[model samples]
Target: MNKVTTIDLGSNSFRVLIYDCLNHKIINEYNEVVGMADGLNETGNISLEAQERVVDAIMRSSKSLEYDPKSAVCVTTAAMRLASNSNDVLKYFEKTTGARFKIIDGKEEARLTLLAVKYALKRERIDSSKFILLDIGGGSTEIILNEGDNFNSKSFNFGIVTLTQKYLTSNKLIEELDNWKKEINLFLDELDINLEDFTFVATAGTPTTIAAIKLGQDFFHYDKDEVNGTIVNLKDLDESLEMFKNSNNETITKLVGRGRVEFIEVGIYIYKAIFEVLEKNESIVLDDGLREGVAIDYCLNKSI
Candidate 1:
């Protein structure tokens, strides 16, 4: 079988995913929270402690890649892009794990994200000529507006972790809500997206986690078949918001796990804001995106 793996060095977590292309099976998958963006905003760099943990996580994930470096494609996102010390961290990762880490800019991130969205739509046979493809990550959000083959994408600096750090986490939750609303609204309004006749698709952890909650469990059981084409209406999203409000860290942790527990509430709100501003009714959820896009490129012998 043709095996391909993609490592996602995210702001909040590090993940390694391997797929057996011939058999269309998942061979190996691993995830760990490293809190890469914990103090990113204040220092504009990946902290020493977080950098240490990131190196450790990458070394652990590299175990599967040692045998054949050609089998895996590893990439880092916003956390690295904005960090002043990112080059040092990347060099350390490469030296220790023998993995070449690539830093993708906003447009490249969008292109790859859209590639994954197009792949999912084709694979699942979901019909839509023009739609928005969105990925909500821990450090950044990649937004894609697709009108047939013509598409445009922008990467916003605010994501679950970053947004929470910037505006949220306080006793005055309502006040924080209004404060963040103005900030995120400005960005969305500036986009001037007219999605009135388009479908909205959401990928990455937040949307999937919201969809997973409907499964009625605290532990997230990642099933792409279940999450890939799921539709999340704003009404269901509102219920998620209320549930988070009544719950504490312990309760939220049980639902979405660590590093994600606190950020998810704000993540959901990001979705709400997007739909409200874009004037879209619902968002279609996809389990695959950036990682899958990398895998697809690797399997095709194409540049990733």
Candidate 2:
């Protein structure tokens, strides 16, 4: 059996997925909500405290792998990619644990997101000629417009943590929303892409939260395969947003799924902005994206 584990070190969270290639199943998975991207706007760098937390988390996750440490592949995304001293942190990890981590660029991020969406959907053929692939991470968002297998993807620097630091926490949530809306509208107009040209397929925590809200759950279990193509309407999104915004930190933290309390508002803003821009009423959620995309790439390359 080919055994492999892929780790995604993101801005707000670190995820590890250990796979049994022969069975095409996940054997072990762990997620750590470590907001490494926080305070970037103020510090202009990742804080040393955050760095230490991430390094410790990575070390612990790495030790959980059934295979050799030398065999695991760790990739860092937006947070590490933009941090002024990201290379230093990477070097530290390499020196301490002998784990080499690669920083993936936006294009690669978008491409992997596409692969993950397709695999999650398990669609052999696509009937729609035009569709949008979206992944909203803690520190960035990748938007892809697909026509069949060929498409265009652009990664935006905007994300929950960045937006929150700039807008929400400052008591300027409405102002930030307006400005973001205008920015997205300008971009869409420049691309000459109309709302009718595509159907939205979103991945990541944001979409999943929307799914839980749509299902009326304060706490519930969600399956990626089950919710991959789930559709949520504007009304449900609005209600959820209101509920989340009205709640205090403790309340939001207790809502459902781990680590959403601090950033759920940003997730809502993302959904609201996208929907408002497109003049659409709903978004289809896809549970599979970047992580599974990593899995697919590893399997195809027989990297294990």
Candidate 3:
């Protein structure tokens, strides 16, 4: 059946996706919030607690899935990139989990993400020659502009987890909103392309969560197929924010999944900011992202 597993060791979560290369279908999937970048903003290193969580998640998932850790295509993102002790952390993960994880730079991260998004667009039959792809991650945000055969991408350092740790957890999200928007705008302005001509598309947690909420689906009932290609309007996003704000801890967790209640607000804030800056009232949300891209890239390279 030619099944292969891909692990995305994200800053906020660890995701394992198994894909059948021969059939081009997903075999199984698992995700756990490890908060790998917890306190990374201040400590300049991944916390021992966070590292332990990752190792534990990896060990459990590897055992449950019965996948060879050495053969899995595992990639760590922004957290590892920014961590001062990433090498030590990587070695530790290898020793404990038997998984060798490669830390991908922001640009490479964007490229791999693009592959998945492109595949989704094609599968959904969304025909567009020009589009702007936004991926809001835990430690970095990547914006990619794809027009015909040309592509340009930029990665910003601040993301939901980092922003939450730096501001929201301190009750400063409101105070820091303007500055955050300005920083995002600065990066967008550099693209120097007329955004009006491009279709805005968003991937990753924020958009998918918004899509699920808009569809009235909670974590337990969340369906990726239904979420994919859903259009999220700005007004709906604002309303969702309000709903999240009013909801209690249990409700928020029920809606957004565990380990995400605290981060979702900051994530939505980032999502709204990007939409407003690009002058778009709505965006096409996709459920496919980096992990899917990794699997697809691997299969293509192997001619599977």
Return the top candidate by lDDT. 3
- Residue-level lDDT of model 2, residues 194-285, one tens digit each, is 66878877778877767865765454455554555678887877788788768777667656456657677777778777777678877788
- Residue-level lDDT tens digits of model 1 in 116-198: 78878877899757888778888887778888888877787777888788775544444554565576557656767665777
Clashing pairs in 2: none
Residue pairs of candidate 1 with colliding backbone atoms: none
Work out the TM-score per prediction: 0.88, 0.88, 0.95
| TM-score of candidate 3 to 2 decimals | 0.95
Ranking by lDDT: 3, 1, 2
Worst 10 residues of 3 by lDDT: 168-177
Q: Which numbered prediction scores highest in TM-score against the true structure?
A: 3
TM-score ranking, best first: 3, 2, 1
The models' CA-based lDDT, in order, is: 0.78, 0.74, 0.89
Cα displacement (Å) at residue 231, model 2: 1.5
* Candidate 3 local lDDT, 1-304, one digit each (tens): 8877999999998999999888778899988999988999899999999999998998899888888888899999999999999999999989988899999998889989998899899989996589999999999989899998778898888888999988745357755756766876777688788888999999999899999999999999999999999999999888998998798999999999899989998999888878877899899999999999999999989621
Of the pair 2 and 3, which is ahead by lDDT? 3
